[model samples]
Target chain A: MNRRDLALGKLRGLGNSIIDDVENNMVPSIKVPSRGTSNIVYDEAKRYYVLGDRYGKRSLGNVKQIKKVAQMVSMGNFCKGLVNTEKTATIREMYYVSEGWDVDFSNQDESNLIVEDLEVTMGISREDLGLMPEEDGASVYGDLTLKDDDVEINAIKSGKSGYSISPTIDEIEFLDHGVERVIAVETMGMFHRMVQEKAYKKFNCLIVGLKGQAARATRRFIKRTHDELGLPVYICNDGDPWGFHIAMVIMSGSAKLAHVNHELATPDAKFLGVTASDIINYDLPTDNLKDIDVLRLKELSKDPRYRDEFWQNEIKKMLKIGKKAEQQSFSKYGLEYVVEKYLPEKLDAM
Target chain B: MNRRDLALGKLRGLGNSIIDDVENNMVPSIKVPSRGTSNIVYDEAKRYYVLGDRYGKRSLGNVKQIKKVAQMVSMGNFCKGLVNTEKTATIREMYYVSEGWDVDFSNQDESNLIVEDLEVTMGISREDLGLMPEEDGASVYGDLTLKDDDVEINAIKSGKSGYSISPTIDEIEFLDHGVERVIAVETMGMFHRMVQEKAYKKFNCLIVGLKGQAARATRRFIKRTHDELGLPVYICNDGDPWGFHIAMVIMSGSAKLAHVNHELATPDAKFLGVTASDIINYDLPTDNLKDIDVLRLKELSKDPRYRDEFWQNEIKKMLKIGKKAEQQSFSKYGLEYVVEKYLPEKLDAM
Candidate 1:
């Protein structure tokens, strides 16, 4: 099924409904999935928030809904225009477009809310509506071929710079590739070093740079790559609470973006390093955990998502030791040690 | 004096001093301007933080200062590279650059600190060091010609879109032009509408957009425009505590950027609207002030920066009314009314 056609069909249906309501002298109403956790149910098996059996109806008769419907109609028209022109817009661009149309988005948050409303109402993602966030997160290098728009990109042959994963992951199509696994690095510095050392060649895996917390597009791409290629995903982050949370976000999904969790999350992705146990076992240089780090570790220890015994023990050890180590700490050994020795050892254990 | 020459000379001096220390078997030391209010004297008449008698010296003998000196040297060398190459870098870019150079900038804040240290130590601003924040805040439309690098830009004649004020404001040289005043708006939407309506032509003033909180560059530009061009500046923001702070940041200077406040703050800039008084006087649509708004309002009521009796009364009245109005609320009077009626009325009152 073509998503553009589906989006266009939704817009046409809305237009017809509005036309019918005007002809019959009736106030039109739009039924959208209600926002927030109240309308979302946590699916334990799926490890994500799915839409609950609850819906919000916006009627033109109500003053607020009248404005809402006007905004919605404007957005629908805008989406229709995007499809017709074969163009894409970032969320910021969408806000500016709506602003130009006099649809009063006082802040980006208001614009985001309407976009979310549109997503729920049409049962379509924003990406399908030709809307994307600013290109952020995920840098890839490995034996993978990707078709971004009309251009086929050979990730492995893209030189030292690697391919920047697009935010519009839905628009990307993967070609047959020989990549065996995917390793996602939290920091760009580490990712660059891995590339410089040609770690991907040795490991027969794609190296994906998360660049701190993984963006939605990065997570989606990772999930798709894993699912489509039957590749195991491994996360390498700092041996800190923040790093643990990053891995948690990839595996179980983030609470803030729970609405799109199932699509974004790679639940089977494994945490490789730098783990708290690795710091002691490898005799890595450590820095005293700051007050904030301790607080975060304590919170993560109490979090249900981190209830696994290994994770619990790691957090406990970090708290007890009052120290943390970064992925860069492996640089103390040598530049090549992280890619050559540390990563190889971790993979062997796995 | 050329800032690059000054920066390079300072770097050379530091290098020679270290060499001298090694020869003499003495610990190397550096004197930098001490941070915080304790070392910052608030100049009431000037409305900025001036360096006090106290200065902080980092020495190799001290464990903490050793790390601080190392970070500072790394940053200084990085700035030297930027100057040598005649290139500009955003704060984030500087962080990444430092990471590439093996400087441990774990986060942006750490990088920001080193930048600040360089500023204080060398008696030079980040802008002078060829460092800028990301391009943000301030859009402009006026009878003004700006020389950004070699490209000449006529703000008034630059098509209907107007000119976005660049983050590298230091590089912008204003050509001889006639403009009565500068009106800096709080939001981009309002600024765009004002441009669309040709409000600048009607009022014979330069319109500058401060998108939400004004960025340092925007503030610096506003200040320089006021100083060099001798234009009275007027700030128009929402009638909320945050809006009040934005105005405060413009007039009295922010504590975080105290060192560069004198260069950035337009002390004579007047707050035009939307004021709490305007809510009552104009009978504007008001939303119930959230807990955060109330809390901010309460804090502003106690802050020295907001000590103006009129400003105090306005905040007090907002707390009493339990309501706040956005700048967008003027849309109730229609789009053209803000430019034609409300602005004229406010200007008349001024």
Candidate 2:
């Protein structure tokens, strides 16, 4: 059977079991592996979190559990309906559906938590259930063709207005591309400048805008291009703790999204950045490092994901300098410096 | 000429003045009132801050001022282009345009600040410049036809999915409807339940979901509906500090958006709420009052906007009781009770 059929069959079995439990006067329950640091093991080699044997169950006995089960059933039915109708919805749209289901979700975070719970319980990805989050934080310009469902388009030749990478990366199939490598930028402003300058054409590379932290789709797309086409991926971001974390997320994947990290991370990607050293080397304009920035840098120094010798030294340098430089600070040199000089030098070194 | 034409004309005049300065080798400068507590006076009568006579200038001499002027010019040009093309963009989109203009806005807040600066400088509203933020928070189910731009929508008759209030409130012209009043709810779940029960029809009133903290557009819409339609507006929220502030925002408007407060605030709107007294009087299920909630309540007790004797007493009682109740707690009585009983009783007293 296809993935959709398998997912639908599992859901049907769950529904039947619940019905049987009700008929037999027994409490209907679902057990899934618990999610947390204690129940999750960090695989050093794979650079991702894997679930442990510890399990948690939701049943109709306790008041809170009853509410949770109701939400699960509501979400399950919602997913089943989506599958039957061949429709897709964002997480925000699903949260709105809570209004009709009498489910009280105080915030988007609560709705997201329930979605994760449902995903764990059903042993299915949210993508398979046809639920996507709002597409954001990723833009691309390249000599590439992408087939999203039935529609196919040449992304690079699509003029100055580049393609916005959709959140549903799994549904998209890369057709053909002649790009040698991908240069992913953390800031949208820098990405736009590069695109406007036609830097992608100059370098024969794909330019991906991360916006801030790279979205799952952007990371997944980078991973796919790198793995399938043997394209070297490079990241460029601000010389700050937040920017460092963004690169880490792109390279090793984030712990917060550990469940689907394997499909979303590009471990082979290298940082071609506005690094801590770049602040002095390029003599870029710097802003005073806030207390929070310092704290974050210190925190990253201790993080396993950021334990690389090069990264550790970079954090130490930033802490000592007490200043951070934005990618936009390259504008202080000249408009063309970023696209013409800085990018070329970085890429040549890579 | 229409508002848009007038705005474009003013923008053109400003652009010509800058050109005149540059042509004559004169240092171009634009002066506007400074924004701060020093330049902002709290008008107790209006319950909002009014701009004072303190002025600041963006001139070509100072490097920082030069940068500011460059950003202003970039934004002005972007706005002029949007007007020329008859296109609307969110503040986020405006920030993306920064790259092409060689202007740096590191974050959305910075972009928003620049937008505010442009508004104060040009004496033109952002809406008039064809800019809009993302529409959110408010949902409406009523016997009302709303004319948004070119489209006319009958809100109540638009099936089960009610109309989400558009962010561009100024453009929305409400058509004739027989609804007597508007009941603005803080929670979507409650709003949905009320709509499902057709409680608005029973009471001959409109129901609007604030969806936690009401969006600026929602507030403006409520104010417009109250003033133009001669509808008595009532607010229902949780017996918590956040909920109380939501009512205050609707009534007096928020300090952050003080410049547009007059157009947004509905001072006559009454709080028909899940007040502290309701927990005891209605015997509603209460949660333990959080420390942050208590702190906020204490802070609001001292604020001029929340100086009503009834409101002060309510805050005092909440602190004394050490309990907070969500509007959703009304569900304990039964799904239909909130619609059939609580609302009717509240409206009758009002």
Task: List the TM-score for candidate 1's chain B.
Answer: 0.93
Error in Å for residue A281 of model 2? 26
Cα lDDT of model 2 overall? 0.76
Candidate 1: true interface contacts recovered: 0.00
Every model's DockQ: 0.04, 0.04
Structure candidate 1, residue pairs in collision = none
Model 2: which residue pairs collide? Answer: none
TM-score of chain A of each: 0.92, 0.90
lDDT of 1 by residue, A1-350 (tens): 67678888988987898789879998888887776677666567886556777887889889878888888888888888777766656576566555466666777798888888887787777877877674343667788987755556666654333565655677678986777899998876666577657788889889997878888878988999888889999999989989988998998887656557777888889999788899899787778999999999989888767777988999998888888888877755645678789999999999
At residue A279, what lDDT does model 2 achieve? 89
Write one digit per residue (lDDT tens) for candidate 2, span B166-263. 54566667877889989988866566567657878898888987878888778888988899999999999988999898898899876666666777
Per-residue alpha-carbon lDDT of candidate 1 for residues B175-244, written as tens digits (9 for 90 to 100):
8677899998887656656765778888889988787788887888899888999999999998999888
